[model samples]
Target: MEFKFTAEEEKFRVELREFLTKELPDGWTGGGEEEGDDWDFELEMRKKLADKGWLTMAWPEEYGGSGASHMMQLVFAEEMAYQRAPGRDQFGTKMLAPTLMIHGTEEQKREYLPPIARGEVQWCQGYSEPESGSDLASLQTRAVEDGDDFVVNGTKIWTSNAHHADHVMVLTRTDPDAPKHRGISFLLADMKQPGVEVRPIINMANNHSFNMVVFDDVRVPKRNLVGELNRGWYVGATLLDFERSGVEYSAGTKRTLEELIQFCKDNSRNGRRLIDDPKISRKLADLTVKTEISRLISYQIAWMQSAGLVPNKESSMGKSFGTELQQAVARAGMEILGLYGQLEPDSKHSPLQGRIEQSYMMSVSATIAAGTSEIQRNIIATRGLGLPR
Candidate 1:
């Protein structure tokens, strides 16, 4: 695979960097409280990206996208990550839209894709339940067919951004007796409906990005069902593939490493610079190597998509390695900063604006989210290596 970027791609990156430098709000460090407090700002920023056709640029023109190449999409994602931009919607723009393009009806695409591309709607995923965290197929959320609609009754836990979302793409069991995986169906439900409820789940970081979403006798039209009935397992699997494959983790790590390197160069310990310390320098070097590997994996996935290859185990490999690298880098930064790293961003003496501390807290969830590291290992062992389950 060609690893070098074309001149056009490099030019696009430069333009994107310039745009971010000029357009991003002053004093916006791309870090903030994760709740309704930043909704307005996020919406405003997202609209700007949408207007530029940067959001969903990799999608087809029929779906209101620019039909940009995969390399361009990678460049855009990297730039957004580096700049800490708040435009990309993981659910609507990244995961759901691509799945819809492949499995959804034409009407579904027409109704859903434009709003997402225009940044007029936001979506949350309703996959994991209280009982079905990693063993997702064992989900008990039922959607019984009644008249022209399906009556949904169950709860989804650890649902990210449900409180701020306009819609939710839910995984429900449409057939009870057919077996664990075959009985599922994917349904798109309106979050504003009467039967839908969202309660915040504050993590150890004190971040309120996650929520518990409950559906009580929620009536969803049969038309909202995605792909074939009792075949949501396949669609959900594909969504996970999209979720796992992305440049965000690697790009974000690269930015953090850059900041940390500068911090080490500027700061001193004992009588010399932190970067001059062999231990700190060696750790940073190791992290740089891992970060580069993560970037290569991300590029490989982009190349696979461009070549029309479905990434199964490769996505798992990337997600597993990338998340682990994020955690390691965050830990190393905190260790390098010592006492100052433990302080919050608001503290006057905090180093790197306490980003390392914040990342340390957030990193705990990286391995658990979008399928855990354990699950990813299982996929690699069984699917990639063809090992016996």
Candidate 2:
């Protein structure tokens, strides 16, 4: 396999790195978006990225993007993630737009696509429920058509950015009698309505990024529905396909690994630097190899997309292995930090400003979000390996 990036891709990476350096504040580690803090900066950064055409670069030009190649998108995502930049909306730009392009009406596209491409709106995914996370087709959220609207009444848990969302891409069950996978409908619901309630769910890291969003008789216009009615299971799966193809997991882990490497190089234990310890060196080396493998898998996904193919099992491989790699990196950081790894982010003497601690707390959801590791493995087995269901 040819492993080299084209000169143009390399040049874009250089320019992106330069832009980030000039725009970010001194010593910016970009933990604010992860912890759900510093909203104003995030908004400003979002618009800046939109103006620069990096926010939706992979989208087609007719939809307000530059029609960049998927490999270009991979490069962009890697740099943004490695820097921990906060502008890009993964839900809108990455997950929802491509799904809309594939399944939405012209009216739906006109109404929703522009705002997302321009970074004027925030979207939360209403996919996971109290019991329907991994087995998503079994969701119980009901949407009944009444005249011109669908009366949606249900609850979505572990919804990221719901409190700040202007809109939500939701999957609702419309035909209970049908098979679970064939009974659902996808709807674009306005979050500002009175029936929509968002309650906070503070994570163990003391972060409020996740929420429990309750839809009580929420009125969704029929015009907002994407794809055919009772086929939302398929629509939602397409969206998840886009969500799982991201390169962020590997890129973010690469950043974490770099920090851990620097810490080992600078710090000492019993008159010996941590990097000099054979076991520690070996562990880091193993992680390095795994991280590279994850990156190559991501590149393959992008290459496939550039060739105009939809990635089902390929994306699952990327998500499953990349997330596991993320957890592995976090655990390595904690082990290397020893007692100091447990320090809170705000503590004065916390190592790496307690980034490892925060990541360690946050990595618990890496495998669970988007889809579980088991689900990905199942997809690989059934779809990729051609095994029986």
Candidate 3:
């Protein structure tokens, strides 16, 4: 099937590119990762996006969004990833807002979503407990009822942006005796409350983006419960689907590939230009074709959403393929850069500011986070192909 952006959509892409050029300062390449320290700058860029209606472009008009089509949303995401801009909040705008729209009460939506669309509040996900990364329903976090609040106690690992989050969307076991999935409830809690502690966990690349969040007597208002009690498994499942949607993967890969190509052309190895080598040329060609396929797969998921159909295993397909391809591209970059690739960004001799080295480190976790590759394949097999365990 043929696929192309509408003329207006293409124009929006051009306008967005121009806007990014004018708004961003010199040499800004951050894509909103590891940004807690410079949160003021991040907030500034996020509000600019909000003003442009780009932060919540796909949200409905009432929620301060332009109600752009999903395809337009796809284009916007692609451009944002390509430019490596720092304004978008995937947690609030991409994950939580959509969940609230579908499962939240009127009061909940009113209180939580507008600030997100305006880029005024920061949110962190409180899933992925110490024992419940992939087996999320098995989380041990307890939320006991007490008057108007549920007193919470647990620790959540790998809680991204928790240090900078103003609030968190957490999954708690409200009924420990019920079946693992049946007893869970989704709750929103203020991060600044008593008994909440955030400890940073710097990755190998030395970026302090992930954290471990500890909650002791963190009281969530009873009214903060999302959807029906003990049914948040389904609600959280919906949010997970949104999380795995993979447009940013291919777009980021495209950026890396472009830079790698340019690097090959501009530099030399073994007394010759790297791009002229037969093996390097072939590798780049293969990655180019695979990147296009990955891009198309992600686009298909967005198209399915636009058609009002849930993507299910299709999301897994895009995520797995696109993420693995990211590793492949980074590996190829290291091969071309050779020993120099090992240098960190701080090293004066490091190539490409050591982005390839960091990409290599970050890509290892890409296949593991959100959900693992093994888990994704299980989903594809059981859901998409109708295979049984």
lDDT of 3 by residue, 1-389 (tens): 78878999999999999998998877876543344547777889898888878888878888788889888989888998888878778999888888888899989988898899888999999999888988889999999999999999999999999988999999999999999999999999999999999999988888999999999989999999999898889889888888888589899999989899999999987799999999999999999999999999989999888887667798889889989999999999999899999998889999888889989988988898888899999999999999998
Per-residue lDDT of 1-389 in model 1, one digit per residue for the tens?
Answer: 55789998999899888888887778656755243447787888789989999898888898889888888989999888877877778799879998998899999999999999998999999999989998999999999999999999999999999988999999999999999999999999999999999998988877888999999999999999999999999999999999999888899999889999999999898989999999999999999999999999999999998887778899999999999999999999989999889999889899988788889998998999899999999999999999999
Better of 1 and 2 by TM-score: 2
Please report the candidate that would top TM-score against the real structure.
2
Q: What lDDT would each prediction earn against the true structure?
A: 0.91, 0.91, 0.89
The Cα RMSD in angstroms, rounded to one decimal, for candidate 1 relative to the true structure is 1.4
lDDT of 2 at 341: 96
Candidate 3 local Cα displacement, residue 31, angstroms: 6.6
**What's the alpha carbon RMSD for model 3?**
1.4
lDDT of 1: 0.91
**Candidate 3 segments whose C-alpha is farther than 4 A from its true place:** 31-37
Model 1 — TM-score against the truth? 0.97
TM-score of each: 0.97, 0.98, 0.97
After superposing candidate 2, which stretches have Cα over 4 Å from the reference? 32-35
